[model samples]
Target chain A: MSQKKSSEPTPLYFVGIDGGGTKCRAELYDTTGNLLGAGVAGAANIARNGDVARQSILDSVKAAIEHANLPPETLASTLACGGFAGANLPSASNALKQWQHPFHSFYFTSDLHTALYGAHDGANGAVLVIGTGSCAAALKDGELTQFGGHGFLLGDKGSGAWLGKQAVVHTLEAIDAIQPKGQLAEAVCDHYQAHSATALVDKLNQANPGVFGELCPIILELAHHAEPTAQALVKEGCEYLSAIARKAIQQSNGALVLAGGVAHALQPLLDSDVQAKLTSSTHGPEWGAIMLYQHGAFNQGANA
Target chain B: MSQKKSSEPTPLYFVGIDGGGTKCRAELYDTTGNLLGAGVAGAANIARNGDVARQSILDSVKAAIEHANLPPETLASTLACGGFAGANLPSASNALKQWQHPFHSFYFTSDLHTALYGAHDGANGAVLVIGTGSCAAALKDGELTQFGGHGFLLGDKGSGAWLGKQAVVHTLEAIDAIQPKGQLAEAVCDHYQAHSATALVDKLNQANPGVFGELCPIILELAHHAEPTAQALVKEGCEYLSAIARKAIQQSNGALVLAGGVAHALQPLLDSDVQAKLTSSTHGPEWGAIMLYQHGAFNQGANA
Candidate 1:
């Protein structure tokens, strides 16, 4: 279905959406720097699962517009910016283009770009994203250099996924006599409510990565409590992330910004080692989108 | 029952026993270096479980004597040496005094001491033990210095137990959406035969430390297959162990020896980084016991 309305300039309102594999969020703002609305929905990483991703994005955007108290027709002249997981894949990007929204302009980029923009306020710098997955990217003179994020199988070091995976390995080793019993094992059992190591095995085989990676917070909680094993795991993850940031800086010699859910959660992990190398972001991805829009670099329907 | 033996010098036999938590083994040797007999029995770590320690020791000695076809009354004098877990505890030495062996002289020491002697033949050196638990110790001028054996709760840095524990944490984190799916998670599931994270929880709770630690071999296997996560865990473990060894060397300024079941298994890990720092033990704990016996240390039964 296609929705259309007369174009009326629309007070230059713009929308920015960050869509990931597990959840999608959108923020809307006007030219005067006033936040119009924000919305959240289920996952929208099409490469992970197409139909779910499409539905999540549509729902998230619609919710934001509705929350702004604007009629669907009012979107006719509004520009939209989207940073979506899997948008780097041509097929996934094509799938996104199929959606028919009543908007005057739309621009799409990889979620990394928006996150970097959000972190750097559209400046030339580097951003390390440590959400469910991990990735590193650097921007210098408007060009981007990227590393890691080959997905869970190949890479994604220092991401929540990486930490979660390490924690589980420790747990299984403890159960199998290849490791020893410790606080991490106790915490895993307590958090998951599983009666034994065998039960955890069953769940691991049946669950998706998203479901498995969710247990990562329990580790963070344990680490905060000074659980040695958990603390060690987090420390190792930070080291990896810091190494990535260092490499990115060496390549681009730019400022650095950290983004993503886990990034904020693990801010303490950045410590002086990472902070000495880079600067923090002034605004997140949504604001980055606004900057792009203001700079006339984003054309709503041009690419589509 | 206490048995009296004739003053026939018991054919001047030397008995060396390695008393571990899992099993106890004793070997009898004559002056010419011929093995008279060998005996094996159950757990004999007196310091760990006091009630059974004495009985376990007696059973092992009886088995060895019986295997040697020695007449109980003809045994005039014998030297018996043993290395047992928890021997560092005073209770372990006290329990040894309760043993009513027909041997004229007996001695006991911590398993670590024997392992060091076995590995380096009483020479000044260091040893890294990564068995059910992990520890590092150095022997110099007949003095011992140790690091990283605060039990499974506090340390055991490079042990197999450490690797196994990391695996479980990763599996749970994957289930919880805190991490992404990768080789480590898959290996954990396969190793445990668990279908999902929920099942892993059950498995972890039902299994004990020994059982959970069994899965450590799987991580080692995965590391060989070039699983990044597994490799990282192993590398981390090795690094920690090496650090402990370095500290030991700094403290004692001695050569290094590697000992224990896990030590042999993790030789590749050690050789990768600290090849020149270590030399594999020419003998295991049994020989160390014999060396202690020859030195007449067993006769004093000194409580240290």
Candidate 2:
């Protein structure tokens, strides 16, 4: 129950965002819960680049507004809540909080958090995100417990980035003649036109996780074709995912939601136990974010 | 054999630099080959940071001139040769070459090249470099062949960065309850004051290789104390080094030189065959750089 101006209580609107490493998605809805518009924008992993993330958020929201046929000023009366990858870092979160936003108010949390909320319909459950990066979380009662979502530098074992980087690693080994490279190495080499270790190093010295993650399709394809190196990489990923999925299930005693860009591709590859615990989401993270905004707004008003 | 003005053939001073991931080292010598002065500066991995590398080259050279009790303007008259890490990357190399250097001439090459030149006194031999990064090279019959040493992200196995990163990876696994935290993990925890998984990720979200590499001392100490995790990391590194060292030995048929900041500490741990090929470096990379410069200068003049 938000305090309203008695003179003229205009209906409010909401926008929910799922800001990820690869892209930012936004959903705009009116007070009556009608989805008016959806928009997508660029990478918004706040931990990596606050400037880019801030711009991405605004861009996505603006695009949603345009698609919804709303006036530009509508943003001033809209409530916004979003989950962003890399906002788990306090510094990144603080940086985003300090953004000069156009919305009436903005609420934010980790990308994984909102995904969990959506997966369980704002109830208690668990989720394992497998995409450019990987991580897992379980909600028990009201508390959220997370496991194995350490960023890229710390191994996100099942992540697309991890698999892609592994391809590079073994390619280097192959180029060094330390091991006989498999089909996967050759595929990666061909992708980058990197016939030698020095050449490969030249191309990727300053590459981000996304660049490495671009090799995932090849890895997944070769793995499907029974390429030993590719299959081995996927297997290693499955092992990590299986461990975390089992833990999430045990800790929360709830169904686990598998999500993210690479989720479906990896879904069938998951262990039987993990598969058994898996469930489909009732709504996407954007919808979940709108729910979060409503709940947060209500609490603030009540506390006041 | 360098061309000279008829008015006066200037007796040029020389400064040789070994620009590495951790530090930039310079050795100044007169034409007579007498060591005049030496200086040290900050990390100069050209691929990671060209501006820093460029500044480091100038800074170290200036410091050496000061140590030689030479005037500040001596930099203009000094012939400089240096090997810098990350210079193998074409972009980094081009960037360095583009710098408006104050030297009489600045000649650049990979840090490994200078190390190999120093190791065998500019003769045909192989050198395995194991410091904050690792790589091996063999030089014979005017052709230099390189092995391993892609870089930190691609896995420079057994390098300080590699060992330290493994500690973090294992520590994260331990905190995630995926595996038991070993002594090395605990040591890493104490160093970063990161008791939980989130705290560690927050602290290291933007950390460079040097930050992780700082944990190398702890890892090395733990390995020395027989901590299984630490020992395993060291063993993994040694395995890589052994493989590359064998290749270098077979290709060059020359003595192998173990060098780098971590070289001495890891020397005894190497396989016996690798040890058998080991020979003392006749000079450091700086001295080797001087040899390279003199030779290059000669050839340049001869061609002219």
Candidate 3:
């Protein structure tokens, strides 16, 4: 066997991808399960805009390969797994599966699945993601359940986008004199430099959730400073997030992880009991995607 | 003298238009101010989409000419005055002014200006547009002021679009187990027949405010039947509307005319004190446009 080098088994490479409405991320790993490199790209929401997502996925994978110092053609020999926002829908899942992908093998699942898996290191637990969007999920006896992540328009009550929308709405009210010019209102006006309501409207009339999401940090800062309006909004949003956490933990009876950009700031504000159940995530979504691919679940239905 | 009749001054024809987020309406009148015909077209909020509004304005004028059994050439000789929703913005006003219009002369003013003028029959009064979008305007001492009409995303708290968004948000929460599936929730589910949370999201993912606005009727009906969720939302919206009404009345010291598709439905639901100031519009916005033009108010700034 040592004399015949051609008979040796080829090394395996894995690319794990986690794509959401705001960004797409990828990590490269070697056969020993050691992380090689990671990369990030723009929005990859398959259901919202499949074409953009496909391109983002491609770009993210290519960037990951470059980061790993691997040959560009290595993608042809790599196994890829992706967990994407909006892929929870059967149609979106099938649409993803039908792609003429370049990878040796490709697997797809919901972003929540990967997030939850990463939260517990492939164990049964719960996760609440509180970033540009918000949602909760739990894994119980290998079964998964999700709730409260309906995107910016419908739900996402505790999300950054939601907070941003509330900030803008309050600012507009202040401008119109419908509401008092509270601290939060004044801050928003100053932040945007919008001297007039009409100019403010012109600036934000067609703004997307991402633009609004950018205001989340300001909202959090204001809330921390105890601005009345910001405090009220933060309180309302945290209440909903706490409810979600309680529900997830109750369903799974396991430790919960609060994840996402705004999660840390909110973690301390959640219901005390809910906060008690919170645990640090063991790995990231990319690792979770790799684990999901190896577990044989990704080959099944949308839930799987 | 009869042979030289052509030398006499020709009677002027006027066309007045009222354009909003929902529709563009036009009325033709003789020099004697006698109604000739009326026509309606699609959306014409100039600030939102100038090109679309321009086309709508043109089509509405053409339709009115046809309704009057006049030749198309009549438009070239007609003095046109338009009261458009977004015309209050300086940029939108300039854009409208730059249009290569067919009318002998075209004058523009804010929709609220015309609405106020029409409400008081060219006198000083207040008007609250409660249709697809909501805004209240008051005229006092020949000066007009507007508030609470910040379109769907920013304000429009008591608007049809606002009510619809609330209904959907409540429904999503109910679907997510964050809230109990009350009567409004059940009705929403039945209305869309969305058996799953994902299915419901699919149905409403890309919906515009107008689509949500259509749900105003259902919301109103449910509130009337004392459905807890709908009633709460309606009550909240009506409180805002009442506040707007009181503000408008207090500013102008004149009767307030509630105008819009959802106005009638929300009228009785408003606070009784505010309701006391309510009066039917003396005339429609098209007539208001005409009145503004005749009064030489349309030739001035955005408010004019």
Candidate 4:
């Protein structure tokens, strides 16, 4: 068979970036199987930290281009897509416009949008992101229709941060001897390196929420070991996340796709309840970016 | 009228102190109604912060004696009573025993015991302390029973700290645009100098639980203006406190006396729903100490 040359220039490469509160990552690829480059940088969520997020996005994009050995001038000609933290808010959108990155076309959406697309391979479904913060998004026919992300104080529910907070609470209770003796008390003390409840308070008071949220993995480890307090925390988190999924399904009439770091950690908890309603995605946000580019979603003035 | 003179020297003096998580206060009185001295210091809750609490109690006691100009040599003949945090804990008992004051006789009890005695004039009743921490205690025919007081994280349902925490959570929800708009967001933001949800994250991350708990007064102040979020917080606190009261009543079968800074602040919130179940106390721990000394509870260790 003879190879046939297409008449039009191959669709220009498209990049999709998931700019989160803690980190920004960019994936570059063409329509074919060529994986150009991947870039990582500091946080890029304007809703989380304004100017820092914008700088992170710019830095990440530049790094990806350099890593791919692509001409810097050609960066402006490539279609770029990003799902950022504050893009859903007008104030954040205005801040993003101040960035002087050159691109042939660009599309910006909330982080939920890209995660949803990534989870469902551009199809219609729901995706729950549970990490330092938590949020759920439902897509119906390629359009986001419902969401449940706001952070810990509001509706984080089953997020790692939430579990970590619960662990701290339980540990403190044990230290006070207010609640009956439980394994969680010892586990928390061990995790924080505190000899007594008073010391634990000092440690917790000094630590940041992000640092505290990091302790969530220890909670999971304890849960696996059958600690009652740890089990209760995970159970509560799973229930909250499941409720979010149920609400999303009710709103969008779609299946559920779990994403983010905490997603796989909580799979065992979710599987026992919503196994039939869930599926894993074959392609992630990178493919979702290409799909958006092909549909002309990344036009010069599309976002405007 | 001539007074009968006895050869036995009258008891030189008696003192009673209420040392709590937020403050340490002591009252000194001679055999007559003459007030000798009064002293105040910072928090003295050994369970919450051991070294700070111990130092506060010692400082307050020293200040009282210094203010009264009592001869240091005569102090050994004085009778003293103290109600302190963690007095109920055996581990704390040993630590407390290390404190040696220049007094002939000394007695110690949990703050709750003194508060109950103060509120009920040494009679049997229940008193709920809803300060930075929440704990409920009931006295039934001289027997003390307690519940709650797990600290800010584990329990403390109706405490100032608990209400403050709830207010923060609601404010965060409002900032995230997850919950309905309310005055709580404005009040909290105004107090913390935070303009957005992300700013709140930083504030909460860096602030200590005590600092966070201080915001309770703000919430209480706003509730007076009929703000729904503020009102809700107070209402919830009242209900939780009442629930503890109800439990104490069921366990001890006694009248109720509510004490503590939070109880006074949220008094308006405790409407008939709470008042119908329990009676408020006219006095607090200070009076309780005097009554204990007068009744010779101090002379008999078992009675104390």
Candidate 5:
């Protein structure tokens, strides 16, 4: 008996997208749950990048599909889920949903949700993300509990941006003779090529989170070498992160993960009690996004 | 030999200007230095306000001259000095000097310098300025030492702005269920009309220092009622100010004054040790500007 190729909406392809203020990442997977390809593009934060967010997301998704050696038409049959920064805002999420996509079905979630999912391999656990920004979330039986993702203006207490702000403040104090100049403070002044407090202030007034975050590694390095100011900043940041971890733990099953670009740098600085509770994430956010496509609480909301 | 108006220059009048981020004030005085009249106008932080600073200064100076019943030409015969918010910055001071003021001579000094000078009547002492922003400075042997005036981003550790930021932070935490919602937090949410954490975050992300500072009074009022979150924020602010006061006292001759719009509100909240060191200001910043014209360190630097 001769048979034609099956074309009954098989959902053969799955796509997972992770979007943030700095960049967007997408991954493509096969029906066998095998990772096929991944791509990255510029920022996809709807509230910040505006209309460009849609283009960035689409570009990243197409890049991943092309990388996987799939026909362009396969994108129409893909089941997709995206966890994005600013997705918690209804206005931002609604605007994002307005963009046309060829996916068989799509679901949206906050980046914090994806991070928590990836950290524990879809299990009930907690995660603290301390990078350019800071936030903490816990998962309990498919429900999410969030804490302290209030952005740089209101909170992000132990974030890279917070540490950077502290470094700048200390550097300015040193220049003004309010504080003693240490190696770390001197390094910060040198980094900005600031010869005077005025110059430093002017430069810092115009700096964005990414530029500010560049100082984080410098400060952490100084902390490692025992510079007083850097040491103090690190201690303070760790304390705040510890507070976040404790709260997250209360909402979870006590499986905690510190996950972000800046997490490892801050790990050793945390107190012994907090250090003891941290576990390595089972999979990256891309895998978590793929899993979310298949079975995420967001799907229930979207379908309803 | 002044039978008629002499063409030769005469220091018949003195003018003093106190410039801040939000407003500028000018006072006119007779040759013997008695206050004649005062005028106030818009913002005058040259670094931040640009050319508008010059206009604000001119408006206040003209107003003061008019109030004093002096001819417009009297400005040319006046020995004028100003202590402005960004006077420490070379570009700002230089741009200020470029303005074609009619003063016989002009002097520039930092606002902190004026605050310290006015607080002690030009007698070596210290002042903690706790207004929309915070800074501490001490005067010793005509020299000034400053602390914690790095603006909201860098420092201003115990300012109204700092307190406001803390209030917003606590409000966000309450919304996320990480902390309990008290009256102060509820007030904040009501003030911003934020029904959700995301709304509050979005509003805060777009806020400027002035808008944020508006929340300070609300927090202070709530603290007065013994609201837990507001009380904690006020206590934290006081501790930082106390630390600043301690540093200022070290550089001073034990004479300390609490100055600025918010100083009185925070005065009673300080540690007893800090309160014990406090002294009343002999004059306001406008008088300090006039004293600066006669004997400020700025004169020595300018003449050099």
Candidate 6:
């Protein structure tokens, strides 16, 4: 018996969502993969904001669909993929999967998953993210390996948060007379208007990742000006990043792609060998989210 | 005033409270310096436990008062001094001061303050508390200066929690194939039954300072057994501790006294120079609390 071709919706269009601790971004594309529109919303880290994460994601996706001037029903027809913070955790991923989205097909993965995918274009390679939080991931064949990203408590070494935290620590030490005040320490004190150890500590106790991250550039600027303490912190941070990158490169035997706002500032401090092996990434994690469906990395489940 | 010597309280007895994160200990003594009794209760870190800290402290002190077999009215006659965790924080100390305790007088200070006083026996010196958390404090001419002990996030450098944290970090690295597993890592995995990197990360995220502190002795035992990784961690811990101790000693220009359960265990790991400068503590923080009255550190206010 010959099966006749039936009229079916084309699976040529896709939506990508990159969810972060600070904000979420969603983008839509057409059959030719031309840029359609993008939308931004608040934080979508499920571990941090819980149920709010779901709403942040929905808002971004809906805004993206509207901005593209597409029919609202198109959101239900298009394939959607997302990579979000804390998605690696079973509790987080399971909760996210239970969300009843209008998309024809939905896929979810960890932010690191799309990061490595976007950085290396689904090839065996390594991607280092050094934003407010840091993580190093390597994709070898299909298996993914991670070195850090243990959150602020256990790890996130060489991250913007780490740098800022170190700066604050040094400032406290200086205020306590344990260490001499340097340019970075002075700037930190000036930033918080903390002239004593007690005041500095009080300020630090109330600080979150965002507040700490704001000090990263100031510390890096001191490094650029050749301040000894700042140079030491930058050197130490780069060393940690280099070590993780080296391990990922060794594991994957592939290219290295660095991401995040702090990455460029830190790259100059990396060892010559690490710098030599670095490669540029053409797309962001949002693009990688869409690529996940296109490359079959994101499962279609019963929708297929 | 000399004519009104009839029917007055002697103000001869003293109560000393040494408050910690995991427990609050109280000791009672007479004017002759004879130990009357001691009692222990739950955590008393006001910054972490809030109202619970006050309850724990009261329970411990009440138990000690009872154990001392003193008259109920003695509590009102006794001079009391408390060295509590987070006492340096104005909010915590201020709240504590508002409590109406049955004491002739009350004094408040950070745990480090009492630790230093106890270790030095009221003399100007330096003390290093290397327990679940680590801190170094120097006392010179009635001035107390502290270094480290900014808690797990910012500092607490050469502490049980820090060592345990390092072991877990190395375990994660080994699990990820970033580093080879060592004896310490093996023990950590065995303890948590974590056979994979993901499991290790999950276990680490759920662990608190107390949980991490439980692992310190295991890591230190491995160090004593000459395990390379454990030795490395111990070496690093000693270096950090030594730096702080050195600065405190230099600042105070006095003898060094080591306190806390982890202190004696870690003494063997200290550099010969730091070890040479160490001196035996004549009294505990309870004694220091008593001495606060003798030294007139506690201000006498209306019973309110």
Cα lDDT tens digits for candidate 3, A46-72: 877888899999999999999999999
Q: Which stretch of 10 consecutive residues in model 6 chain A shows the poorest summed lDDT?
A: A1-10
For model 3 chain A, the run of ten residues with the poorest summed lDDT: A1-10
The Cα error of candidate 2 at residue B91, in Å, is 0.4
Candidate 6, A30-85: lDDT as tens digits: 86789788988977776555587788888888888899998787776777788887
Specify the poorest-scoring 10-residue window by lDDT in model 3 chain B: B1-10
What CA root-mean-square deviation does each model show from the true structure?
17.2, 3.4, 5.5, 12.0, 7.3, 5.8
Cα lDDT computed for each candidate against the true fold: 0.68, 0.83, 0.83, 0.68, 0.77, 0.78
What is every candidate's C-alpha DockQ against the true complex, given to 2 decimals? 0.01, 0.75, 0.44, 0.07, 0.33, 0.33
Better of 1 and 6 by lDDT: 6
Q: List ranges where model 6 is wrong by over 4 Å.
A: A1-15, A28-36, A48-80, A91-107, A120-123, A271-278, A294-296, A299-304, B1-15, B28-36, B62-80, B94-107, B271-277, B293-296, B299-304
Alpha carbon deviation, residue A83, candidate 2 (Å) = 0.2
User: TM-score of chain B only, all predictions?
Assistant: 0.78, 0.93, 0.91, 0.81, 0.87, 0.86
Query: Which pairs of residues clash in candidate 2, taking residues 3 or more apart in a chain or in different chains?
Result: none
Which 10-residue window of candidate 1 chain A scores lowest in summed lDDT?
A: A1-10
- CAPRI class of candidate 2: medium
Question: For model 5, how does the per-residue alpha-carbon lDDT over B239-292 read when each residue is reduced to its tens digit?
Answer: 878877878888886678987778999899898888999878899888887777
Cα lDDT tens digits for candidate 1, B161-183: 66776677666556433467788
Model 6 C-alpha lDDT per residue in residues B1-304, reported as the tens digit of each score: 0111236666777788898766789998888988898889987876665687888877887788899887677777777777887776666666776776656766768888887888787789999889877888899987888877777666777788888888887887676565777788889988888777667766667566667887888988888899999889899889888988888898889989998769989998787777888999888887887676568665322134
Q: Write the per-residue lDDT of candidate 2 for residues A1-304, one digit (tens) a residue.
A: 3323335444388888999888899999998889999889988899988898888988899899999998889887877778899877777776776676777667788888888888898788899999888988997875677888788778689899999998899888988888887787788889988887888889986788889999999999999999988899999999998888788888889999988889999999999988988889988999877786666622222100
Candidate 1 error regions (>4 Å): A1-12, A31-33, A75-77, A98-105, A293-304, B1-304
Summarize candidate 5's per-residue lDDT along A23-142 as a digit string, tens digits: 789989888888898888877766655577777777888899889888788777877777777777676776766665566666778888887887798899999888777888899998
Model 2 per-residue lDDT at A20: 84
Query: Which CAPRI quality tier does the interface of model 3 achieve?
Result: acceptable
Model 4 deviation from the true structure expressed as Cα RMSD, one decimal place? 12.0
